[model samples]
Target chain A: MTVLDIQNLTVQFGGLKAVNGLNLQVQQGELRCLLGPNGAGKSTTLDLICGKTRATSGRILFDGADITNLAEYRRARHGIGRKFQVPSVFKELTVIENIEIARSRRPGLLAALTTFRTPLRGRVKEVLDRVALTDHIDSKAGNLSHGQTQWLEIAMLLAQDSKLILMDEPTAGMTIQETLKTAEIFNSLRGEHTIIVVEHDMQFVRQVAQRVTVMNQGSVLAEGTIAEIEADARVKAVYLGH
Target chain B: MNRTNHYDFLGYVAFAIIILLGVPFLLGFDGFELNTFARYLALAMVAMALALSWGTAGLLNLGQAATFGIGSYVMAMHLKLAASTGNPGGMPDFMGWTNVEALPWFWQPFQSLSVTLLAGLLLPAAVAGLMAIFMFRGRITGVFVAIITLAFMVALQLVFIEEQRFTGGQNGLTGLAPLELPGWTVDTYSLPFYYLVAGCLIVALLVGMLVVRSKVGLVLRAIREDAARLRYLGYDVAAYETFVFCLSAAIAGWAGMLYTLVLEFASPTYMSVSFSLAIVIWCAVGGRESLVWASVGAILVNLAEGRLSDMFVEGWLLILGLLFIFFVIFLPRGLYGLAVAAMDRLRRSPRTEPPVPVKEG
Candidate 1:
């Protein structure tokens, strides 16, 4: 089933058209990769979906609901989690505390306030384990390494319990081995939730994302399997570099 | 082990509480008016509330005094009216001069102690709630929030001063009676009043402590640290801000009602910008994150003023300004922040150095 439906979406800022007439859809629990070079509206796509940026004209349907105008928190409660390009975990909070905030944010206010209503602690542990961050659960998030911060951000998204997560460049500053371990974590979470990831790394895109969308100049250049998109003439002409 | 980073600090607070409680009995009586101490405790109520909202939540509300003043004046107006009808206390002179044959309709309900108590909390809370809705929902934050509220405080104070016939002008209402608790009339100005203030301080602290220790406190901290990330995480940053703003003001208002009983009058000075700034300084000196420290900061700073005024009266404020700078630079976390840091270092150093079971106790 289609988990996200973007139709005739456009975003304009003053005189600049950041996004124009983009149409796309993702399947349930699907890992869709959006690839583009610099200034290709890759970040803008996530912004529009997450309701952080305004849409000049568009219809964004999330799980059969029209969330075009829904604010981030309302959209979050309906299961849309977001991660920025830079690591955005709670720095002053511990690794576990950061997850606790995420876990609390995704639920209803009363549910979030009352601990006995749900086993938030165990669920937090589960997410920490998935990201291989269980050992540093009590450590402050600010003290983490660059690669570890990325994993902590992922762990935070998992704690929110949102079915669809929007991640911006999950492995931007990671070493090759760290990227492989991140891929393992992403692969492990495949069937349980949908993830719309934006990354410029071609190899990482090919490693995990089943289907890929290539955007260029505020529009889609190609949308198909990773191999098909990597081979497209238009993709190579605009994004892959001549 | 969690190492009790939270409780290690509480140990000092527990010691302080014991001293505060035992002081009255230990000294026997030092000509200290019980009524004034009660009043101090009531003011502490406002201090505790200020700590939670501004210190922990990172909201700079320059109009907290405005909220407290509103509650105080409203409660005072009611008390003044009650004295007019067969009460032994002299009716407020302003009422007699205004040549008012009867009390205004709104002031009628405040005559009842139960009703006055209810209005004391609700009226200011309602006003604060409405103001917070307009500000927070509009995404107004930081200096804007502080400035707009400061403007409101100044404007409200002006309104109270100018509408002299109603609020008794700048002179304020005096000759007011005290709150009559169950089986006891609180007229005497002894430790009974001090105990009353102490009781209020305890309740307000308990409530503030509950708020700061909850999951709500975590969200508040997160909002202060980075609100944009909070929005992306699917949390309503504005709503949380509004909730804390209103909650803080409500507590401040509660404190003000008790404060009126202590001072026996409410005036425009209650809502002055200087008062708001003083609260901020108190929180800064005590510790912003720890509510208990904020209270300690408020009381200790005021106590310092008393001693300094007796000795170097003229240079006290100058010394205070220097103290403020020192706390901001060297003690950025304030007193509580410093204590928290020291505890963390103490907890961490054990494993780093030799690791011989780490005699934590």
Candidate 2:
């Protein structure tokens, strides 16, 4: 079953057509990689799906519901989570606290005051363990190394209990070893959650991608399995030019 | 372990004890001194309220005094109405002075002490909630929030000043009757009144502490650091921002009521930009990140200002300006940061240790 469906999506910035007539669909529990060079609307496509950037004209259907005009938080509540290009964990708070904020079932004023004890501390610990960050749980997120921060961001996405996860360049600043670990983590998450990850790293993409979509000049140039996409002449000429 | 947080907790307890019990008993303040101290506490309450929004929630509310003034005016209006009970038409002295025959409709509900007290908190909170909705919902933040709030306050001050017939114009609502409780009336300069203000200050401190120590406080700090990240986490960042804003407004309003009880009047000057900035200075000096320090900083600074002004009337403000500059440069975290640093140094020094648990015993 399709978890996300985007039809005739377009985003315009004044005279610039940032995204134009992009059509994409991701099956539930599927791992899809979006590969594009600089300014290919790869990030913008994720933004449109998550309501970070409003579509100039498009329809975004998520889990059989039209969330085209939904507010960002509302879309998130509908089980969509996006990890940004740069690690965006709460720098002032500890790792556990960052997870706790995301793990909250309901983060209302009354819930914050009356709940007294955070019931999700154990769940947060579990998430930290999953991200291999249990040892650094009490440390401030700002003090974390770049790769660890990325892991922490992933833990936050996990803690949110999202049905669909959108990650923008999840392995941008990661080392080869860290990238392999991240690929392993993505492999582990594939069966439970639908993921659309945008990346420029060809090796990381080859490792994690089941199917690939190549975008260029705000439009899809080709879509197929990673092996097929790697062989496409158009994708090579536009994105992987020698 | 986080040594700074531990020190901050201890500092809060020590400050609370000093303000709540030590000063009233240990210092042996005379009636005048006590009344002055009460005023300082009221000021501290307002400063702490500002800290809640500006420090914790990352909201720079430059018009806290407007909410505080509104709270003071509500209480003063009630007192004036109560005192007018013996008048021919039950009209306040100011209303009669403006040649008004009947009381304003807004003044009618304030006649009931309970209603007035509730209005003091709820009215400001409601106003702040509206402002937060407009600003936060639009994602207006940083210096813009400050500009909007400051402009809103200035406009409210003008309204109060222009509507002299009802609000006593620039003079504000004065000649208020002593607050009457079920058993007794509150005398302005009496020990009982000082105790009443002290109780309010302590309650305000407690409420601030409750918020700053809760899981909500952690989220608030997160929001301050990265609200966008929170939005991606499925949290309603704007809603949290509005909640803290209204909470701060309510606290400021409550402090305003206590301020009126101490001063026996409400004035337009209370809502002035200078007064609002002064509240910010107190928080900055005290350590805006720490409520206990924020409150203590306000009271201590005011006390020092009083003494300095008396000693060097013209040069006091110049001295304060220099001190503020010094704090901003050398002590960016304010007095609380200084204390924490001192504590850290003491912890580090070999001389401060107990010789590694002596084996003699």
Candidate 3:
């Protein structure tokens, strides 16, 4: 089934079309990579999907339901999660506390007050182990290294039980080993959750992308398997700068 | 609760014991001293209210005194009516003195103590809710919230002062009668009355601590650190902000009601900008990060103000101003930071060597 279907998605910032007349679709549990150079509107597409930015003309459907104008948090509750290029985690809270909040069954004022006895310790432990951050569970999130912070954000998304995850350059500042570790994590999540990754690292994409969508100048230039995309003359000329 | 919260609980217990039993019995506090301490406790309640909204939730509400004053006036109105119930004329003395022949229609509802208490708590919360709907719903926060609240408070002060016939004008609500309970009438100046004030403070502290250590606190701190991120986490940022804002206002209102009983009056000055600022100062001085310290800071600051003003008369303002500046400059974390650091040092002193030994060549 189609998890995310974007129709004629157009975003205009005063005559400069960041994402113009774009159309894309992702199947459930499919790992798709969005590839482009600078100014390709890849990030803007993610923003539009997550309701962070309003489109000039578009419709977004998640799991066959129209979510075009849903508020960001509502979309999040509907199982849409995004990881920015920069890691954003609650810096002051401990790692377990951070995951516990996201893992809460009912995250609201009254539940928070009365249900203090159940701390989500078991769920937090499982997420911490998944991210290989079991030792840092009690440490403040701010004390973690850059790579660890990124992993913790991924753990947060996992704890959120997001059905679809949008990642923007998840390995932007990682060491090669850290990048490979992240690729392994994403590879492991392929069939369980739908994933759309926008990345500049071709090597990382080669490792995990089942299908690649190449965008340029605010529109999809090519969409195919990795081999088919690499052989496309238009993609090579527009994105590869051939 | 974890280790830190466990320690905080112990600290609260110690504070409760000290105030309830130690001060009057061991410290030998007389009626006057206890009454003064009771007044300080009331102010501390206001400071803790600020700590919840400003320190925890990252909202700097500069108009807190508006809510506090509202609570005070609501209770004072009830007390005035209670005192005047048996008189030949049903009207309070202020209504007669101001030459008002009849009780205003609005003052009729406060005749019931339960209604008065509910209004005393809910009125400020309702006002805060309206303000929150306007400010937070529109995503107004930080300095703008501060400015709007301060302006709101100043406006309320003017309205209270201008409406002379109803609000008692500049003289304010004075000559209030003793609050009558079911069987025992509360003597405002007595030891039991002081204990009642202390008990309120203890309850407020316990509730505040529970909130600060709960998942609510975690989310509030997250909102403080990064509200936008919290929004993306499927949490309604505005709702949480509004909830904390109204909750804080309710607490301030509750404190204001007790403050009226302690002082035996309510004045327009209670809602003034300076009074609101003083509450903020107390929170900052004690430690906005910790509720216990914030309340202690309020009491300590007020105690210092009383003693210092008595000694320095003319120079007290100058001295306090210098100390505030010093605290702002050198101790940005406030007194709570100092306590945390000292505790950390004490804990580390015993662990002189690493648990795992290194093998030397």
Query: In candidate 3, residue B290 scores what lDDT?
Result: 78
What is the C-alpha local distance difference test score of candidate 1?
0.77
**Order of models, best lDDT first:** 2, 3, 1
Cα error, residue A227 of model 2, in Å, equals 1.3
Off by over 4 Å in 1: A116-121, A240-242, B1-5, B8-16, B30-33, B86-92, B99-101, B341-361
Report the lDDT tens digits of candidate 3 across residue range B48-79.
98999999988999999999999999999999
Q: Interface Cα RMSD for candidate 2?
A: 9.0
Which candidate should be chosen as best, given DockQ against the real structure? 3
Interface CA RMSD of each prediction in angstroms? 6.6, 9.0, 5.9
Q: Positional deviation of A160 in candidate 1, in angstroms? A: 1.3
Q: What are the per-model DockQ values?
A: 0.46, 0.41, 0.51
The alpha-carbon RMSD values of the candidates against the true structure, listed in the order shown, are: 3.5, 4.2, 2.7
After superposition, the stretches of candidate 3 with alpha carbons farther than 4 Å from their true spots are: A117-121, A240-242, B26-29, B86-89, B97-101, B353-361
Looking at model 1, residue A16 earns an lDDT score of: 81
Candidate 1 lDDT over A38-154, as tens digits, reads: 888989999999988978998999999999998877888788888898888888877777887887454444544444222335777778877777777667788777777888888
The candidate scoring highest on TM-score is 3
Shift in Å, residue B288, candidate 2:
0.3
Q: Indicate the residue-level lDDT of B208 in model 3.
A: 82
Q: What does candidate 2's lDDT look like per residue over A1-242, in tens digits?
A: 99999999999999988889999989999999998888999999999988889999989999999999999888988999999987888888877778878785776677787644354457777788887787776677777777778888889888888999999989888888888888998999997999999987889988889999989989888999998987899988985476
Q: lDDT by residue for model 2 over B1-361, one digit each (tens)?
A: 2444566668777877887678878547577788889999999999999999998987999999999999999999999988889986888887887898798788899989899999999999999999999999999989999999999999999999999888899888877899998898877677788888888877777787777777678778888898887787777888888988998999999999999988889999999998998899899999898888889889889989988899999998788788788888988889888877787677778676652221210
Q: Is candidate 1 or candidate 3 better by lDDT?
A: 3
